[model samples]
Target: MHQARETDIDGAALLAKLNGWARSLGFSQIGVADVDLASAEPGLMAWLERGFHGQMHYMAAHGLKRARPAELVPGTVRVITARMDYLPHTAPAGWQQIEFDRLARPLDATVSLYARGRDYHKVLRARLQKLADRLAEEIGPFGHRAFTDSAPVLEVELASRSGLGWRGKHTLLLSREAGSSFFLGEIYVDVPLPLTESTPAHCGSCRACIDVCPTQAIVGEYRLDARRCISYLTIEHDGPIPLALRASMGNRIYGCDDCQLTCPWNKYAKRAVLPDFDVRSVFDAPTLLALWGWSEADFLRHTEGSAIRRIGFERWQRNLAVALGNALRATGDADIAQALQGRRDSATALVREHIEWALAQRPQAC
Candidate 1:
């Protein structure tokens, strides 16, 4: 490990410098967290035991190492957590209502706002590395590693510990200044930086996030059943989506933002300082039929530099098929039926099953 130089370091001054560099790099905020995360282990174990993580085997595979950052990265004494607001600057003041309105449109494909732009993993990871490099240039070399949702790191735990914000009832980091419309990145470093004070949670008596869930994925406050989560069903779970949850998924083809959309704190969500988070044109107002029209090559070409591409074409088609099914059930649109029929024979087995299910959907008599 290339340790930081043995010199008298002013922790406060170093933090100030870090904040400045972070802001200049499109980071909204930066905080330091001590590596002793033993307190969070029991909760981690319980969540895993409940199988709430669904198909994300990696969460269980990492075991308690996720809470023990020092074990994950030897010589790590503090984790520097970063917050980058991801709401596109073009978002209108009543954006929450706008999103809710979008969800009501059964034919429109609704993606999680975060995944609408450039892949956040690529954006945050590169920026975090540059931040680490800047620190190294200032105080000589240091043993450090950067992570942005790419590892088994207890990201929200570390971020909350570092005073980024309190954990919202929906299990996402929420800030008074930025809400939960942001991405978090971390730099595990050997530097003994001053720890930031964790903020008090402000969820109060609100149950908006819990009530608005399409599939009741948030079984309780701060407890998400990933198995039922639209985000997980569409993005993480690589098998057939549960029969019960498909209709509730509505037109969310990529990820669901219903929880975040309903959170009162999100009214304060900040816009991204960098253009990297600007919504891609293809995703801006995509309809289920329009996206269903994309061939595998078109899907690949369009999703280049996108997080959506990581799911591959098969899952993409599968998600769209489910959404089209729900749209057909809701509107009985002939065009949607035609689109599903056109793709049925050519679709992979997984997608074909969903397409078949879609073709079977008919509007119920009221």
Candidate 2:
């Protein structure tokens, strides 16, 4: 617990100092938001009702508490929303074109670029706490809580209202200058900081993102059916992927970036200012057979600080199997054939089933 000075600090001056601290901490922008997320409640309930959240039962378990920030974090009067650009410094100059080209291959495994390095949850949460600690130094003792995609809260709505960026049609916060390739974090505090005006949506008649989605997960403007979303299928959903959308998933082994790649604003996507987001070697254009060779220990060691670890080794194999199946169908390579054959006896039934599926796609000559 930290305390704030009893002698009230000038709100504007305090905000300026907070921004400076946030920038130093690698946050691209910081905005204060009021807790009145009343408008989002209906959409939240509807999304849950549709079972769009998939196996993430926690989304429904939290109920309306997600809309009530004060309920989740007591004494929270204002929410400090922060954005950190995550496009890796090593990302190619025409990264969007490269990503789209990779997707076109349908056989090349495409892990979302964001997950190819360290887990953003750990990175952003640590920095958000640092920002909170810095605020404590300025204002003395104050009740505050920090969150980075920890759920039980509507982060994007909070961020949009706080002027971080407008919610694009893809339901991701998009900026004319920054695009949608960033991570968001929040600090719920007792202090009532000045709120910033919301940015208006600039996505007029453009529907490139909607048209480009292979799964048709973006049901409409600002609405996503997570059940059909590859990110949810690969990362959030625990069971086997829905049969209907499996082939449509292409070679997205971990997460999907088609929506973000198709967004025109992403042309301006900036490289990460911090080295924390640099792409790791394991994720640097590895072949499906190469990644499928990792043992459980190898998987844990390689992804120790990465978001991919959360999917666990079994799911990791399952996803890789799907991508390998696609690769096998595309290239008819003997290595992919041998790799699928090698994994058929995997201990996990889920992994075995996926391996069997991959083996089924093998050409008759094999």
Candidate 3:
């Protein structure tokens, strides 16, 4: 382990100034965390052992090293955890009700609220790097690297340890001030900053998140079966989605926000101050048929610089086809059936199978 060089600097004062820089960069809060995360390793291993990660093999590939920051990034003595609220600035009062209302409409294509914005990975990485540069200017050049939901970092663990917030029962870091509708980013540095005090978990007896999951993904408090999660099925899992969980997916084409939306604490969820998290117009209230109308080229062009692009066109259509199938069963719309037939011949085998399932949702003229 490399030691942080002593520079006769007041760590608390330096952190205060650094917090100012973080605020200017759009971070709502910042906390200093010691790099020792050994205690969290066992739970990480157990979750992997249960295969809760599903097809995300990378979670297991990192093994126990994910809980060890020094192993992941040597010379890291402290991690600066940041929370950036992602609810769009234009999101009105009672936004959760609006989200639930959207889900009730079978024809509406509901992308997760966070993903409707610009790609957060790029936004947070760039801004976190700038925060590191500002720290370098103050303390002279220092060894540091930035991370934002990338690589093998145990982000929620680091955030909770650093007192950004306590981990909610749904397994997301939640703050009484910010709620769960935020993006987390971190800067691993060699600086030995004073650690922030941790907040006590306030979940109490509330099992709102556990009760709200459509797929029953939350097996228990702080335990999740990601394989059964709509968010995981829609965004992370590759190849054919399991048929058992498809009906629970509803019209959520990108990610599911049921747990967070149902959590009473999320009533305190804050809106993003930066325009970078603004909602794209095409996604405002797009119908499943409208998104299905887009050619692969249109998908690429429209989602340019957006996180949804990472899923690529094939998976994009696969998800839409599932939602279209759900819509057919719910709305009994003939236009949706016609749309499914229009694309059946051209779809890839994976998409064709989903298209077949969609077409079957409606019966032929007997």
Clashing pairs in 1: none
Q: Score every model by TM-score.
A: 0.98, 0.96, 0.98
Could you give candidate 2's per-residue lDDT for residues 146-232 as a string of tens digits? 999987979999999999889999999998889999999999988878888899999999999899888999999888999899999
By summed lDDT, which 10 consecutive residues of candidate 2 come out lowest?
1-10
Distance (Å) between predicted and true CA of 68, model 3? 0.1
User: Which regions of candidate 3 deviate over 4 angstroms?
Assistant: 1-3, 363-366
- lDDT score of residue 277 within candidate 3: 89
Query: Model 3 lDDT vs. the true structure?
Result: 0.91
Q: Give one digit per residue, the lDDT tens place, for model 1 in 1-366.
A: 455334478889988999999999999999999888999999889999999999899999989999998889888888999999999999999999998899899999999999889999999999999999999999888889999999999999999999999889889999999889999999999888889999999999999999999999999888999999999999999999999999899899999899899898898999999999999999999998889999899999999999999999999999999999999998988898888999988888999999999888966641
- The lDDT for every candidate, in the order shown, is 0.92, 0.87, 0.91
Pick by TM-score: 2 or 3, better one: 3
- For every model shown, the clashing-pair count is 0, 8, 0
Give candidate 2 misplaced runs (Cα > 4 Å): 1-7, 363-366
**All candidates in order of lDDT, best leading:** 1, 3, 2
